[model samples]
Target: MATLVATPRSRALGFGLRHAREARGLGVRELARLAQVVAQDVSSWESGLRVPKLEQLGVLFGALRVAPPERARLVELARNAREPNWLERSMPGISPALSTYVEYERTATEMVNWEPLLVPGLLQAPGYAEAIMRAHRLPPRMVEREVAIRLRRREVLTRHDPLVLKLFLGEEALRRSIADPAAMAEQLRLLVRAAQPRTSSIRVVPANVGYHPGQAGHFVIFDFAHLPSVVHIEHLRGSAHLYDGDHVAAFRAAAETLSDLALSEQESLALIQGVITGLE
Candidate 1:
């Protein structure tokens, strides 16, 4: 039986609520007072920790003065927040926040990834991903499930209208080999093949580049045509989705810095090819 995981719709709605409130220069307490709800409730809503009831949602939206179209969208999200789907069945160990990130990935028109450790999940080969999961001590069953989901995630790369992928990898990512040399070689070859300019742009930040923003960690920025951009930061325990304008802007600036410091597309491919040759 497939375990049911909560959808990220509430998180999306919370993001919309927080954006609407801040745009109106209203604090959580102030909005709570206007909406006749506790301040903690407002905080929980914005954090995506809780979903507001319909009545509370109505009052909160009214207090924030959300515009009609966006308000309608938020309402729809609140209404359908818990609908089940195949993602839950496929990605068994994925957290609610990650599920939300997956949804963002599915809908995003452009994705910017900064990976300092292993290869980014979307681009990971199944064997490489399995090696990674095992290294993390995941049970064999869970590792197989995760590898399957990771492979499914790669579909985004081949979709008819594929999302533009701007991938930045740290030098260490290439230097660090997974347990199996053959699998690592396959992964490197895959990376080189997927770095086409038209669909995906891949760059490598040299180890000698000295301290830079990417050293901070792995993160991804998803940009949508009609929705506000979001920054996702993953950690050992869980992940965080940053929706505030300033926070998102700061991450964007960091992405730009990393991009500027990374090796050119041709250079990165050459570096990857060199690694593959060494394995051969």
Candidate 2:
């Protein structure tokens, strides 16, 4: 019942390129001639039916006389276009990482997030996000920029047919206040409130669980309408998007085990409230 969907970025990039061509007073036929690519190829790319390859991207960029940084961005986008996987499709531009995150949020039917170190991005309040970003010493403008992006991302929760977000947090994340006590309390209350059946659900893994697979780090598993479940593992340097049958099975098994070990929905809210009280 699951089918793999191409990353939204591919389509967006293709559309951008097409628009760029038209803005330059060049038709698809003209761009194809300039890029030395087939007219059908340009047509397919513009229609989002297919993405151009790396060499093809270079030719197109050259034809447009795109600047170096812009050309580099386009090349990066082309590299991302490879395999038409989430790694390629979910993000298409310079900020591909964040774009990918946003795209997944849009199309996902279900999302399971486990974060061991910090609060999950989807649920972070602006003040809490700002505090964390500041501690990391990001420039003020960058911190503000990321906070804005994160807040915008929250819109997914209110969409007509929103993605079901199931979050599992390590107890330490809740117990350790990232911001001031007042801010932390508000975030804790927010988490508890957000667990309502209609919108979102959250469960906390007690530290007493001793050891668990998620202890290694943070990851998100997404279920898409057209694809089998895929797990996104994030690291300090890079990320791996897992879709292989075996890897997907293992991640799913881990999620099930974690869900079993974590507190039930009602108990989780109680636990959150307890932490909020303890914070004061």
Candidate 3:
């Protein structure tokens, strides 16, 4: 049988559906029988060669006894297998690309981030985040909303089975003050506290590191267990999600280079501490 090329959304749905079914010890034939579909159809769905209709997805998940949150996520994925979920309709001014990026962040098991100008959103403290948003000239309401979103994003750091985050931050990110001296100091201290090696690692690339792939701009690599990895690049207008294997590999290599150029975790923490002390 010719294999169907799988896009990110279809791949996610297929993997989730297949995982749920296998966890219940059901083979493809068994699941097909239970869901009243042909064996080839079930195989196609599981392989991401075809996306199941919403009603069919309901039948499959029901047979597998998939539970609440996960079942809802699977349904969402099935409904939008060909395109990103339309979050902008619900979230008034939110960029469609950003909405999709948020979904990717939620589902990703691991994330590698390279930030050249400021702290990554997942690590920015509330005060600093607010300050940065305001500096971007966002409307007062939008600034507040964006800051709230940043804080909410940070929740992933503390969630049960939190994401494995590897962050490469430019040294100037530490010295750059987004808010008042006190707020910057607090933000630096928060960075020190959150730099736990098990769940999160923060590394700073010194200013003197003359040239690197990261000099191109900020990007994030989202890694999944079942679906293909993707790289997200953000710009002033919108963002780009790169799924092509070569592009993904190049970004992965860049991440490794940045990691190597960055200071050790302990050294990075000490440098942050020194910056905080200077602020005091």
Candidate 4:
């Protein structure tokens, strides 16, 4: 049976397992019979609700005809499936952090984002995103690839049963100057459009709001309908996903703090519009 404590790493491993099975043209029952497990357990493993043991992973991967490289990567994920937090570094064969985050994002029923320095990734306009990526000095191809991926991520916001998002932006984020004024204005405009009644709540935290929990850093909280919540903390090198109760609670408290300090949705919209006026 599947449980709510499935970690993002487990989900990534499950994603890999499902991909490998589909690539080999094996259905759940077909693979389950080959691996000597019930079809429901295979479904549970593929959905990340339950993790198979190391021995079971061997049987499953062997049955799926997964390549050595991918099998090694997935096996590594299974090895750490119970870890409470995941630091996005030194992942073998594939970049599981991106996969893990994307899977969490897609499945999360509600998302609370706090960005002090820039627009949240999901809401970033293409030009604003490209400017930030180029500033990082990423190669042209990588920039294009990331930008395209970001655009795809936005799809989640508008899909059926769209994500219930609470976005808290720092006041300075609206005024910060980017390479292109038009793009910056457009970015703010995007914020205005997305901050409507049925879309999302976009609020701003004034810079002078002395010392708050969010001052420590930016983070995102993803809440799932039938599973445990996950918190994502992004830093200079990479990001970390937190799945344990204490860590997730700390971030949730931070979200509550930001909610108290941020401007009202309407006020935030007015201030954002004012910034757009300044840019023009």
Candidate 5:
């Protein structure tokens, strides 16, 4: 049977150990004997059920035949796995499906987004957010809370070390009136204001651009401070967290293609201003 890896920290460490053991043609029992730990404990570490102490890591490293620096890297990966994300503590009762995306967002140094149906959450004006929520038929209190969360996410725009927010919005998103035309105008203005080069960027994919890569739905690619990049796909009922190399590559390609085909930042701002004027 496959061993269970531990949560964030121990999981990485355990994976490294297992990879090393497999490379050395050793079974779980043999690796456990070399590391001076029980096989079940090793399995638990691999499965993310528990983390390894520093001493335990040293033993694992010895068994894995790793040098000091490589061993340190494995240990650091394990440490990150063990650390609980801020979103886990701040919003305890939220859906589990959202936790991974939130963790990626809070820890990311760069974020790229593409939304076809509505304003991206981070850039949403409060009224726009509320209107969209109402349209979705969320309970009143839930709408308020979701709006609050969206507003809070905007802090990333002005942090001391702000993240790079590159967003692409479909022409349909801009044209459709989520709220009153006046409210939509305000939302468009907000998008323009947020698009300034220093803090954020906005690009519009014109209707003329026709078919494109992100035709299916919205997705976000998060580049974390030190961890691997992640892609988040949201659906009606749930969300998916993708971290494998191949999936990340596909999303990256799509983002690049969209960015290339979409109107430039300046042009997009002009387009949004035109919408605002028409609405007024």
Candidate 6:
């Protein structure tokens, strides 16, 4: 059996497999017995330590009675499980990209996020997130889904073995009002509270900071304890998760540069509060 590298696609594929098995109430040995595979191999496939043969994946899906849409998605992920990078576009009903992102984010040890346009999702208030999504002209159902996801994502900060966050917010992001002043102010207040925890750090990078690494665009580096680091770049249309060593290193360097360009933590909180005062 060929072992699959712990790339983002493999991780996502593993998550899909585990979810399918759990949904069907099949334990590893039970699923393996039905699929005619070794229970240990099944564990490896579900942990992203190995890639299941396409035939084996099919058998497992048949055993689990996976739905057509989800079965197709898992098969696609298995096919691309060895890929070093995964680029995903938004899809109707639910976005595969978003689901993959959430899967990786949940297990990440630390996240260094640089945003030049808006607050990081984990730091965003429901009202603020809803406003931004509404401004994007998303379908109302999708907007509600995204808002709910955003709110749920914030719990990662307080969950056991919580995700450590390093956020660099752009000055213009604070200036660009969304929804209404009152809502924006509430959002800023939320940021202030989010910055208080030791596990989270919020810093503001002033606009026109002259040539900074963040000028390129926004990205996040998610460092994991046992898996390779993944660099995620998001845009208006889609998002890409990068696992190549060079790419991850570049994002790490960019995170360092952003740290240098950003205001001190205390100063950042002051600026956030100042923005909140202005809005009020």
How does candidate 1 score on lDDT? 0.78
Q: Which candidate, 3 or 6, would have the higher TM-score against the true structure? A: 6
Segments in model 4 whose C-alpha atoms lie over 4 Å from true places: 1-4, 90-94
Error of 2 at 21 (Å): 9.7
Which ten-residue region of model 1 has the weakest summed lDDT?
83-92
Can you give the TM-score per candidate against the true fold? 0.70, 0.76, 0.72, 0.91, 0.68, 0.94
Per model, how many backbone clashes are there? 0, 4, 0, 0, 13, 0
lDDT of 3 by residue, 80-120 (tens): 66652122222246543554666677778999999998988
Among all windows of ten consecutive residues in candidate 4, which has the lowest summed lDDT? 88-97
Winner on lDDT between 3 and 5 is 3
Model 5 spans > 4 angstroms off = 1-93
lDDT of 1 by residue, 1-280 (tens): 3211223566667767887898999998999889988899888777555778788888887787777866777787777666432112123366445556666787789999999877988889888998888888999998988888877877887899898999999888987977488998999998988887998999999999889888888888888775557677876666666665677889999999998899999999999999888988
lDDT per prediction?
0.78, 0.74, 0.80, 0.85, 0.74, 0.86
Comparing 3 and 4 by lDDT, which wins? 4
Off by over 4 Å in 6: 1-4
Candidate 2: which pairs clash? 3-226, 3-227, 4-226, 7-89
Off by over 4 Å in 1: 1-52, 55-92
The candidate with the higher TM-score, 1 or 5, is 1
Task: Give the Cα-based TM-score of candidate 4 against the true structure.
Answer: 0.91
For candidate 3, the 10 contiguous residues with the lowest summed lDDT are: 83-92
User: Deviation in angstroms for 25 in model 1?
Assistant: 41
- Order of candidates by TM-score, top first? 6, 4, 2, 3, 1, 5
Give a tens-digit lDDT track for model 6, residues 1-280. Answer: 3555788888888888888899999899999889888899888787677888889888988998889998888888888887888888778765778877887788899988999988888778888889988887888898898888888988888898889988989998898977689889999898888885579899999986898888899999898897788899987788999999899888888889889889999999998899888888
Q: What are the RMSDs of all candidates, in order?
A: 12.3, 5.4, 6.9, 2.5, 11.7, 1.8
